[model samples]
Target: MAAQFATEAGDEPMNNALWRYALQVYSRPGVESLLLRLQDEFDADILQILAVLWANETALRISDEALNAPDYLAWRESMIQPLRDRRRACQRGEHGDLYELLKKAELEAERYGLGLLWTVLKDSPAASENCGLQGLMLLCNSEKECRELLQLAQP
Candidate 1:
């Protein structure tokens, strides 16, 4: 299933360790729909959430400023958002091929953003404990919703 989203060979290998970790967490039951809601309704940045998860796993602290860095937002607005808009537009019609293409491009854009985030924290040391839940709470609409989403992300 993950192979469906992998970048082609000689394409810079976008599916790095952080991306793999995201796939693993995202594949957990109920996570997909919850994440979709977080994205569509709450304006949550999925890449930021994934980066925070990676930071928690690596014991790196990601400040709110870093998570909301201008570069990241600019990338999302220019790359991912346009693709997402096209994909959503295509979803309203019989444009399956176009939708699929847009979806792939959006995923690549997201991977690129995640890679940038990983680069920012590459030299940091691991923490003794994971702070994923706290990170999720910051992105989620409420504590209850965050807790529910965390439960879904966990096996």
Candidate 2:
């Protein structure tokens, strides 16, 4: 984990840490795939939380091949019961409560051969040019991040 993530935490901001952690988790293999699957199959609460983190996710994906091959929807069905059971359910206004969010996301990403999550984040049009450095930082904690991210995602 240390080798995969950035050690020096300069004035980058909270999102930088989030991205650093995300990339480490993605490079671990199986983690991205599982998380992707969890995104679709998990629950709305989980999906909403993911949507929030994804809003500011800056972990740059190191692998290009892994980019076009994210088949998470398929893996969700096979995830262990304990993992699924852990899936969080959020109410509509209950968007910004994702402190332990990484646990589930990490578990899923580790389950798949996914790599370079931040790069995947690049796919988002909102992140264009901006790199979402601030957005990621501000929303590093709960639905506040999700709400902000969602606003950023919106046209």
Candidate 3:
């Protein structure tokens, strides 16, 4: 399913660990809807949530400093959100080609943001405790919804 969004080989950002992890997880059934729900209901940053899950999966601990990725935040605010708003606006209209272009641009911007997050988090310490999905709740609004997302990650 996620393959539908795949870019051609040699596209920038495909080599990043976070990008690969995100694609793998997002390809799972039910994962995409749950993620979109998290985004829409909580206004959560999907990349940050993915980063936290990636950290937990790889036994890494996300520090407060790493989470405060100023460059990524600035880029998301300036580039991603406006594109998302415009793309969504097209969803309510008939601008099909424009919508597709905006969607692609939004995804590329997100990939760039993920690279920034990886730079900050790549050196994080290993997790000494099992702070997995529970840790994600801190970045979400509703624990129940987060738990729902967590279930999809479980084997």
Q: Give me the candidate number with maximum TM-score.
A: 3
Q: Give one digit per residue, the lDDT tens place, for model 2 in 2-49.
A: 222333345142244434454554455454554454445533223223
Clashes of 1: 1
lDDT for each candidate structure: 0.71, 0.38, 0.77
TM-score for predicted model 2 compared with the true structure: 0.28
Candidate with maximal lDDT: 3
**Candidate 3 on 1-155: residue-level lDDT in tens?**
22222322443443577787788888888988988988998888788888887777777788655766788889889999999998998963578889999999999888888888877776677789766666687678788877777778654
- Misplaced by over 4 Å in model 2 are 1-42, 45-48, 51-70, 80-145, 148-155
Cα displacement (angstroms), candidate 3, residue 9, comes to: 16
lDDT of 1 by residue, 40-143 (tens): 88888887877776676556666677677777778888998998888887864688788888889998898887776655555455456667778777776566
Pairs that collide in candidate 3 are: none
Q: What are the candidates' C-alpha RMSDs? A: 5.1, 12.5, 5.1
List clash counts for every candidate, in order.
1, 22, 0
Model 3 residue 72 CA deviation (Å) reads 1.2
In terms of lDDT, the poorest run of 10 residues in model 2 is: 60-69
lDDT score, residue 102, model 3? 95
- Cα lDDT for residue 66, model 1? 69
Instruction: Mark the regions of model 3 whose C-alpha exceeds 4 Å error after superposition.
Output: 1-14
The per-residue C-alpha lDDT of model 1 at residue 60 equals: 69
